[model samples]
Target: MNPKVSIIIPFYNCPYVDQAIESAINQTYPNIEIIVVDDGSTEFKEKLAPFQENIVYIRKENGGTATALNEGIRSATGEYIAWLSADDYFLPNKVAKQISFMMRENVEASFTNYNYMDETSQPIDHWTRPVFSNNDDVYRAFLNYNAINGCTVIIKKEVFEQAGYFNPNLRYTQDYEMWVRLLIEGYKIYYLDEELTKFRIHKESGTYKHQQAMQQEISIVENEYKPLLKEYIARNLE
Candidate 1:
């Protein structure tokens, strides 16, 4: 049997959440579960009603994406976890292809390339991330900025048990911090050069609305992890 994958979609009041749910439901991979975390959504609650039967819906008081994700993760039963932002959608073969790569490479965690879409779901930029030659380069790149897109990542459930969950206080940069923490715990995020996820950018999206705040949090995470990352590089990397 193919390994089961739990696709967790952290949802707020974003209108495009239905699309995210649909994408997960439509994945080509047969062995997968969709967990939709509703973070106190008020405006677009009706949008989720149609698909509530198709997903594991958990509604909690408004906390943040990190909290929503943690809730979903705790409830997940699959061997692997994949995060799909409420505004983002994955291609049909996203899980199947990424799982194939992870099994073949013997990696516990990995992130793939992703394209961009607008609020209307129209394609924008294609494959927006830089190509890294090796894990060393990937770690070094983290010193400057986050190269891994959280929505494109698929990680082993056991990895979280060892590295711990996302920091609840990090409202925006939790994914960035989590990625760095995994590295600190000696978990490598292998890169799969396939654009399997479509990240949506809209006026209401947190990335668009929280630019300054996100940068501040990113800087804090970078500073907190930089020393450790440098030591890891010196100790492990060539």
Candidate 2:
């Protein structure tokens, strides 16, 4: 039997939420559930109307994305979890291919390369991750930067149980912090070399709107985890 995968989309006031829900609904994978967590959206709640019957919708106060995702994770009943950003979307075969790869490799967590898309969903550019020959290279990459995109990741639910959930205090670097925490706890995040997610780039997108704050948060997370990751790489990978 195929493992059930839960695709969690944390939404705020983004207008592109319908596209994200559509993509999740259209996944080629047979066994899947779509969970849309509404993070106290003041607008664009209408965009979710058409998909209301199709997804397990949860509404919470205006918590950050981390808290929205944590709520979704806690409510998820699937064996595996995949996060989809409200402004981004997945290719039709994303879940199928990633799940097959993880099962074949016996990996508990994995991430993939992704492409860029404008607000109109026009193709922008393809972003390729380095072909790491070993875990050390992957771990070292995290020390300098976040090599994994949260939307591109498919993780076993137990990984969260082991590493804990995304940090709610981290407004911008929650995903980065979670990745580092997973690595420090000895969880290997395998890489799949495929552009299965299209990350939207728009002026209203958080990346474009909060540059200064994001950088500050990134530095704070890196400062705290860099030493631990360095030691982990040396002791285990070297």
Candidate 3:
């Protein structure tokens, strides 16, 4: 039996968020539940009015994306879970193709390649996300760098249940922490060679900005992954 997928979208007044929601609602796969978290958007309320009941809209006081995402995950009803940002969109086949791969491979988490687009939505560059085609590579890629962008991941609900939600303490780089924690735990990871998501790079983009949040992110990895990093390194030695 195919499990329903809960699609979580964390948003601010990002003009592009509406486009992201539109893309999710029109998925070729209808077994999806769309949950949008309005993380204290002062202007987007009116823009989002039309999407009210069609999409599960939750308004929370201004917090960070990590908190907003945690709220969405708690409200999700589907057996499978995935996340997207307001400024990004997914291909029509994004859910179908990736979910099919997860089921066939019996993996807990999966992601695909992505393209970077300009504000006008033109592709400027691409990051082929096949950095971790297998579980072993997933661990390796973590220490080297994070490759699986949160928007591109479709993970089983159990991953969140066992591994837990994004760290509330983190305002940024929560996705990197989440992804690394999963890989370190020996969870099965599969990287589809397909590009099923579009990531837009613009001024308000949180992760794209190299700021203090970045420094905090590195501190997070060093502190949280300390034990696991050592364990993975020991196991990898041939």
Ordered by lDDT, highest first, the candidates read: 2, 1, 3
- Per-residue CA lDDT of model 1 for 1-238, tens digit only, reads 5999999998898888889999999999999999999898888888888997889989899999999999999999999999999889999999999999999999999998888888788888653567887778889888788889999999999888878999999999999999998887789999988889998878988988999999999888988998998898889885
lDDT of each: 0.91, 0.92, 0.82
Worst window of 10 by summed lDDT in candidate 1? 125-134
lDDT of 2 by residue, 1-238 (tens): 6899999999999999999999999999999999999999999999999887889999999989999999999999999999999999999999999999999999999998888889899988564445666556778898788888899999999889877999999988899999998999989999888889999889998889999999999989988999998998889877
Q: What shift in Å separates residue 50 of candidate 1 from its native position after superposition?
A: 1.7
RMSD per candidate (Å) reads: 1.2, 1.3, 1.9
Clashing pairs in 2: none
Write down the TM-score of every candidate.
0.97, 0.97, 0.92
- Candidate 1 colliding pairs: none
Quote the lDDT for 4 in model 1: 93
Q: Which stretches of candidate 1 lie over 4 Å from their true place?
A: none
| Candidate 3 Cα RMSD (Å) | 1.9
